[model samples]
Target: MKQRCVKPRFWVVLVGTLGLAVGCGKAPSPRFDSNLMVMDKYDISFEQQQDIANALAALFGTPDDPYVPKESGLDKDKIKLAAGPTKSDKAGVHTGLYREHCAHCHGISGNGMGPTAAFLKPYPRDYREGWFKFKSTERAEMPTNADLERILRHGIPGTSMPAFEVALVQPEIEALVEYVKYLSLRGMVEIELARQTSEELGEGERLPTTAEFLVEGVLKPQAEKWSSAETKLMPVAAPPADFGSPASIAAGKSLFYDVNKANCLKCHGTTALGDGVLNDYDQWNKDVAEFRTKADATLASLTEQRGKAEEDFATAVEALGADSALSEEERKQQRETLEKDKAATLKKLGEKERMLPTAMAYTLVPRYIEPRNLRMGVYRGGRRPLDVYYRIHSGINGTPMPAIANLVADSELPADLSEEEKAQRRQSLQTQRMWNIVDYVLSLPYEPGGELGADISMLGRERN
Candidate 1:
């Protein structure tokens, strides 16, 4: 199977199909301008929008007169226009749970640009992109149905996304998941159709079979992704003996900073400050080169000021004459080499300025993400050793952190080993190294200056 690499540009394909055309027939839905839509970028005019909208209407119908994909294998019972808990008093009175809880942030169309999105710091995730940040699946794979349900149940710890398990019943949560997928699929189809239409227009032609193409190209592929998501999980073997011993941690620490191995120091920094550089972008800030440029300029300006200060100090010492320990000529010479003898105190101040918050803004939008400072002992994922293992084995799905164990290769295997045996041996070696990494990471926060040379116990026991 050919692997699909999702481009960030694809995530920006916005859909404006709210069934409004520009009349009082129904109020025009407010347009989302923060994101770039395919229709706008491809110069898809009002006529083109209507053409695609009409084609979609013929296939999916309008909100007032909906067209459900019952024939396409979608469960009729699960498909719904609304989702939420029952209104109470009546035993079977179900209200729009999604609207009541999620719409304000997630938006009515699941575009992720709700009215309140402006006030949020990280901003609500635009689901139209279909790029979920957290998942158990491998990189670039769509999250499984269970993954979505888990998020809805557990909620993201650091964001405005709340846990719905306490507020809604299991059935309600399941229904909402269906609705979310439905909206997501609808948005994807809208973008796909727009893209197909744009291509046809470029060639001075028309799509041969709009409906059939949509069914095969957009609907089937996305549904298959949902179905196959659970299958992409990275397998793990049982941990090596004495996995949490001090020796294991020592080995793990070696691997963590090993330039040829884990290479964690490249991003996590030597002191675990999340300041490592790759292509001038660290985990916390994009386009870090821009910030570094400004810091450098600031340092240059401070250096010039320090030169004047040195001249002033020399003059003051010269006036002291016999009262001072040095002669006037000695004082003048010492001032010229202020930075030679002792530490260049001025450069130290400049470095301190780089660590300040004001100097770290890398982009116009306040987007800032730093690599995890392991020493803080704050992990969004659970604090158990197993959680760290899962992160190492699978990697954070949408971040720079990679599946470290998956990239390792065991060199001494038999030349003609069977595929099964090879897989078993690989898993064994990978799991052993991963356990070492987990042990070392768990020891990070307690290690002074993020040093891992000390013999220490794993911070938490493995759940597995």
Candidate 2:
């Protein structure tokens, strides 16, 4: 051909290859399109994707560090099998490593959350957070190795943390443990520094120690121990225990609604409905919350008001139709022709969140907490009903977890505590009842068999 546009052909190859790489076009350029193979979209490599998936899978695993040298005694770099810590510098190095590795979701100091924050729920702890919510062996504190291990071994089911027992080796797990303790210790130290650095009563005055992050009690051992590179992580103690008994459960039931125990009826109401069907402890308050000042709300009210709105919308739509008042038959014909045009004018009202909606999430009564129907003892949290029992016992932080720590009489219970001695015995029984009730509560959400509820794991229990 007559000097076949060699110049154009040369430029086509160069432009196709270089244009996508240099971002010469505007934003939303067709660079990501498979047609443009010059560069990879999202700048992510295949390896990185695998890593990200691995990282996500790890989250759903045990929430605790997996490595605590079993009787076999573990050390990776040194490979020495020993029960106690070998090197002290290793402790400090491990501490620093935790800040880089574990702190994000677990907290800047292993409190649960470092940088990958905001994207998680059951939100990361403050580290300076409380301990011993349920099935706790320690009076109250961050879990011992035993507690942490169970969480790590099984991984809280529904949560993002996953089990790592398979992917991570036992020795690496030990390294992680040392690292976590270091973070906890480091966090404790940071709190101390913050206090010491605070502009207190005077510039020179040292910040007095409260409970932790101080010289005396909490951080002292940590500091001394870390200095020696004491890699010895304390063993986590087993904390699980059984629910009280039938009598204790009955006692707990009384306290659940009664004034003596927690006096929950004030907010929860008599029938367990936020509605005060049994009595009026909070008549005005309930009215204020559920109150909607709009002109029409009830279905009866909607039945009255539907005509005008639909009629007006239909009138406008009829602009495209041959006849106006949209007869039933004609409307059905038009509906078949249009999809998005429907629901264009109907104004719907959704329940407004509380003035302090998030706050109310904590204060809500147990009835509103929304129990998932359980097919078996295994909850999304884990296999143990005791887990929920612990949650109930300790009460979830920051909200209305309803601390049944102290049992009381139900508002529904006969108000007849005539004898003080009887009351004391009842209180004792109520305490027991609290534990039983929790078990019963945990046992709930199981499928109901006839009038009786059956375990969902036994759903096939139905003879039919």
Candidate 3:
């Protein structure tokens, strides 16, 4: 296993505190002739590398960081992990998800400039502003990756972020974090250039921007750094539990219905077939109706809504008039430039429609007719643990999936409490019966299997 050493904070001046500098008292940072502190902070020194290794001992911790614990998400473990999965690979998987699902709103670069970004609110985490809120107040003062995982699983109430665990597994959700971190880091670098240009050229002239600088210098270095980390973190695929053990399958069955835990049967049903109870629609339908009634469900409506908001913000700025007057000429010019970005963002969304795979997408509806049963995930929209996790947290926005974090955190459970928590109690009961029921369910369909035969691959041809 490659040893992990944390990188020093690249933006040293940004978080400039020297308390950890060990005996290096309140000395001011030595002046640089022309060097920017952000770039210089990254210079790798042997001593600094040692410091990073020490700092990361919690992340690359002795046994593990309890703040963010890890476990086998596999149904039955077959592959043995030596050092455990690295953070980069886990994040890369989510990067792919962004490419598939989120890039439309979050943008490939996560700059809140996705094709649909102009239409969204709070404008997708400008990622460049790397101010993450989920921090630990504990004396140790570090947040776990698990906290991120929880947010992914339960959508934050009153916001746009959605729960995603149902669609992503624990490892896959980990992958999303790495991808976001990559984008966030990139955004930070670009924002630095913006800050510099705004200062240097006095905000009139656009500063130096080079295709080569973007492609060859910045993008290439980042890819190299990230890909190297990814290869080091690729996790071993887990092996299935020994099928013949009987006891293992029995345990898995018990886990399903054991209650107080993964009460999957509530939505999945007792037959392990889609026969279980499902949650009733809550306020989602009403919200969708109200939203669509006033605003079109199509992308065009969202675009219009956002455009109006921008125009309003501009008007508000203009209304500052003499109350907060900028010189007349300066105000006019700033207004023009501000309008350009708003227009650009809106135009970006309209153009993305051309990229939609209308032909292949529609043709695939019934095309080859592959019968892959993926009902284990009933969320319908997604099929991975991370998908479910994100869905729960982010909610369906206009849908019934409410932001569970706020509800649970603030006891927002309606006093009406749908069905008086019928699903909760049902879920608990189902969990209690999980493992044994699954064993029996699987056994019911058993036919002799090859090689290991009756005890092993029960439903297949026997071994010669």
Stretches of model 1 off by over 4 angstroms after superposition: 1-36, 40-45, 55-67, 71-76, 81-92, 200-202, 207-210, 277-368, 384-386, 405-424, 448-464
Q: Compared with the true structure, what per-residue lDDT tens digits does model 1 show for residues 153-196? A: 98776567778889878877876777676666556666766777
Regions of model 2 farther than 4 Å from truth: 1-104, 128-135, 138-140, 196-201, 204-218, 221-385, 397-402, 408-431, 447-464
Pairs clashing within candidate 1: 83-97, 84-97, 284-369, 284-370, 375-445
Query: What's the ranking of the predictions by lDDT, best on top?
Result: 1, 2, 3
True-structure RMSD, every candidate: 19.3, 20.7, 20.1
Better structure of 1 and 2 per lDDT: 1
TM-scores of all predicted structures? 0.65, 0.41, 0.26
For model 3, what is the C-alpha lDDT against the true structure? 0.38
In the range 191-299, model 2's lDDT, one tens digit per residue, is 3333334323352344343433333543464444433332332222232254445554444456656676555444434422232233322321232234322211333
Tens-place lDDT per residue, model 3, 1-464, is 65443233321222122233423234322210111122122322223223322322222132111112121111111111111222235444222354554555665445444666555443444443343433221211212355445666764433466778677676656656655554444444444443444344442344334545434443444344323432332112222344335674565444444343344344434434433433342232232233333322434566566768688767856675544558878777777777776775555444332222221121111111111112222233333333433333333432222332211211433455576485565443333233233343344334233311234322222111
C-alpha local distance difference test of each model: 0.60, 0.38, 0.38
Better of 2 and 3 by lDDT: 2
